[model samples]
Target chain A: MEGSQYRGYGMILLGAVVSITIIRLAYVLYWIGRPLRPMPKHLSTLIVLGSGGHTAEMLRLVNVLQKDRFVPRFYIAAGTDNMSLQKARVLEDSLLENKGIGNKDIEKLAYFEQIYRSREVGQSYITSIYTTILAIVHALWLMLKFRPEVIICNGPGTCIPICLVAFILKVIGVRWSSIFYIESIARVRRLSLSGLLLYKLHLADQFYVQWPQLQRKYPRAHYVGCVM
Target chain B: MEMSGRHQSPKTENQMVFVTVGSTFFDALVKSVDSQQVKDELRKRGYTNLLIQMGRGFSIPSKSSGEDGSLAVDYFTFSPSIADYMRSASLIISHAGSGSIFETLRLGKPLIVVANEDLMDNHQIELAEVLADKKHLFCATPQTLHQTIRTMDLGSLLPYPPGEALPIAKLMNRSQNRARSSRSLLSPPRHFCSNNSPFFFVDVGFTVQQGRTGDSFLGISFSGCVLLLHTARPRLWILLLHLFQYISS
Candidate 1:
């Protein structure tokens, strides 16, 4: 009798779990029906940052953003050695070969935003300080020239440091800001120093994490399933 | 999908061709032949509406191949020509580079992204894997390249999954619909919560830091364009109670 009772409990638990999944799926479908409200057809342009696999993800996001009336411009941030900028440019060539995207085809701009580091151990502090100041200058350029409503970091590279400058700008006067992650969010500990930096900069404006395991570390991070 | 080596006639509307000669991982030998092989195969399979751009770092050098007996391909040394082709393609075949992925997806065009491991630490292979996992692209290996194209069906692979699409669409739509939108940055979130919800409805901002200095400039000798950085800032938003209740019950 006890065995049978235990079996019944197990069956009940499994049924509950299954039902919840179905219902949640239904709610998600419903919510999606609201239609993704588009941002202003323009913002300083949603420049996508990337190095390799991540670069593709960011670029794809840029494409999706472009479909709507409010399409953002494309920009690539150079990584570590600021080398990503040149590598990313190859992608533009790749665009020509595969997708057939031409520089003149869309109202877009492509350039590299290199990130620098100080050589001397002593210069590290000074490097950070200078980086901070340069970030501020770049922020001002973005604001004054291509003014974006919200900044979307598809690739983390320059996005992290730039976020600091943006943060400073926001504190002083800028109003809109946000940072998104294109990878999993189950564990913050595993995130690169840059990922952690971005996570902190936005402080919660909005994060589009890709996995559940990451949630344990980023309690506030939302699992959008996949941002690719 | 009628393809042509020659540009389509002007009367054609809603027409596009995919010219996917993926990136060559610094390969002088493989790249020399990849383009012509693709073009010939695609033509035989009735893919007449195709335009192609050879992979990156391959330029004026290949055209000279006509002088070589081993290099049977009529390679074009032209790199810039791809820009025109990109504008013409309704469908795109690309190497697994982030820029190609971004361009195609943003254009809302159908795509097939091939992997070129030689580019960066076999990163393209992994990149293709992630995109395939998300159902955003079609992919294949070199051995099966011809077969995949011969029996290609884009309808099934598209449209991208909603979870991914919704958030992106929301941002674009919000940007378009709101005339009040102006130059301003949204504040990073202050609270934290992790659950699958439509909260992706809000926008996630970006930052661009320039790494220019005596060291980076002297060490690298080039400015990096597409840098991948991370943000550890915590953004918190309330979870959809509906998900909790729905999952628990």
Candidate 2:
């Protein structure tokens, strides 16, 4: 009787383990295909601006967005990029002027932050690993504090850490930081390094490409037709 | 009367030719455009001014200003308003950066894009080639820039349509409509906090400095792991309990 009872307990344990595994898999699948939940009246947006062409392209996209909807915009740039932040400020000023928003409302509506670059232009790979981790930690801090609903970025090294943290938030059921990745117009034939990482890893919810060749090459990416 | 009027006019027009390498150094582009052959080509095309915005490049053109027979040449390290120069110029020769190329294109100025071969991955060339194929601009390497300048016909170029972001905006609106519920893990603590901005008080400097110490680094990582575990417990337990009931049944 004791032996049979032990066998019964063991069978129950095995069944429990198997069922848990199957259920967990099913939950994940459901999460992936989960229907859109109703959003708040206004979304908190985080815009990651890169240097030069990346900034120009991203700002052009930002310029077209309805300001009233994506309120309390948070702009993040690489710490070393002096010009990009200045450019963003210019854009913000223009936006403020166009809308005739008062100076007192600036702090509430728009905030600017900078995150350290994971790797500089010439940094070696060994050192880059350490810096990249630091960047992720920094990005995590920012994401937690801001808790933005939307994260938009074009191809930039800085975007990698920020987007990675946002992806983690989604997976761990922390926040639904919907990531929008727009490939640069300069990339006609192939995706840039950042674009390739986000595309292959499925980090971005909506990946847009300007050139059809790139879209054909990466079937999952949407062809948006020359957004610059 | 047209031939006599042309003869009566000054030999050189007040037209300017702007050459830029964008934000980074492109010594080859600056050096190539500085050559007497290229200057003579520009002067022959009725351009009397050649302005070069050579960014971080050590190569300054041999001619500083206009000499007796040569066009007026000027050089600057960088400029705040490059568009101003593009607006005034009859012709523009710029590095194959999408910013400068599109800026020039949007202004309806003729452009010759010189692709920097040294850039790794060299995606700039593809944009240049595509634009050239569309007859929107001319494309050339540093070696062929002089030839491109000599042969490029400004009239043959077509104007690029004004860029539109309406489609992207629409897609983004749709995505926002489909966003997940706000009661996720991070939302509760934010609501609990008194201040509008919760979790804003962090000593980033001290935390970053702790990375150098082996013990502290481990401690931080451990704490981070623990935090993740604590927060994810609710969802984890619910799923496990549901599965356990299903299995027994």
Candidate 3:
């Protein structure tokens, strides 16, 4: 009797595990396969500004995005700096590798990184001068090359330079805009949602909030949840 | 321009396509699938009129990402023909890339934007979000991307115009009218910023730092690129060095 009862319990445990696995798989399928807006007629180009996981996710969505719209040559990256988004960037790289892509074909690469500061000489400005100059030079090079249309940003630091470049492009008759993700949930990793929210306002073209409290506080924010 | 009716052939009637953005992901799917299956599926899907901008550097994909829906793909290198594709396409789904978006927008056609979170901390998301909120464009995510496509509303969408093209032309004309402000006389920007004027990138106004001998050295004002009362030695040195390099190189 004891042996039979033990077997019955084991079977129940197995059934529970199976059920959970199946449910999770179903959710994944539903999320990935469900459809919505028809792909708009393609723009001259849609430049996805960053690289890595978010980029990978963006790429995954393209399958469905291409239905009515034309899929143009797109950049699949998480962000410029690979260290922060190591995993997602790696996946993007892997996806690229799977396709056997080698290098981007451009005639030349501009290595100039320039930073312009006012005539004032402050400690913070002086300390960061070299790095700032490098960034400017790089920005100018990119400006001359990848004249983008819209710029989307999750944070201000790196995106700012790209924007400066994009703005230059705009000045020269290019069209562009910017967006922000408001990623406090993952952006401030290890920090509690409340604690991380302590900083300044979450700014963006459109703001995405994860928690209800945050949504209440920032009335204008859209609650997209933690898509990551 | 004249209107042309749909051709007798379904292939002829379909729109010719060009992908000026998002090759990174499409290439992966292309590599992972069997070429034969990809061609078959693409044909079946009625995508007889399609072009993938591989940009000359082609990458191959591994087996897994394409295991299920592996077949029905095509990839091509980006070439001058892309200009033609841009002209031909009825739709252009791009990566919100600055270059591609501007050209398409200047054309004043339709557009769909996908911000790449990969570039710099997902700034692209902000770009798409802002444009979408402004009712200038549409945005999507990988998971919900297909849905965005299936239900995409094209009526409200419009292409962006080239940024402030005519005004700057006028500014250039006015600057040309002023002899001192020729392209060569441009000093650093601080002098203009301090004066509370919208400054152009090529605005040339700098303080000439003269010494005891009344020897004048042209200097670029660094402080906010504005309010140039005096000149610093460092910029003078840089100017000299730049000249030296220019002549030597």
Q: What's the count of clashing pairs in each model shown?
A: 103, 0, 114
Better candidate number, 2 or 3, judged by TM-score: 2
Best-to-worst TM-score order: 2, 1, 3
Q: What is candidate 1's lDDT per residue for B37-104, written digit by digit as tens?
A: 65456554433343335445534333322223222233332364455666666556676665567557
TM-score for candidate 1, residues paired by index: 0.41
- Model 2, which residues run further than 4 Å from truth? A1-35, B1-12, B178-249
Each candidate's fnat, listed in order, reads 0.21, 0.57, 0.00
Best by TM-score: 2
How far off is model 1, as Cα RMSD? 20.9
Name the regions of candidate 3 deviating beyond 4 angstroms.
Answer: A1-228, B1-12, B22-47, B55-73, B134-136, B159-162, B168-249
Number of the candidate with higher lDDT, 1 or 3? 1
Q: Rate the local accuracy (lDDT) of all candidates.
A: 0.47, 0.77, 0.40
Kindly list the interface RMSD, in angstroms, of each predicted candidate in the order they appear.
15.8, 6.8, 23.6
CAPRI-style grade of the A/B interface in model 1: incorrect
Going through the candidates in order, what is chain B's TM-score? Answer: 0.44, 0.67, 0.48
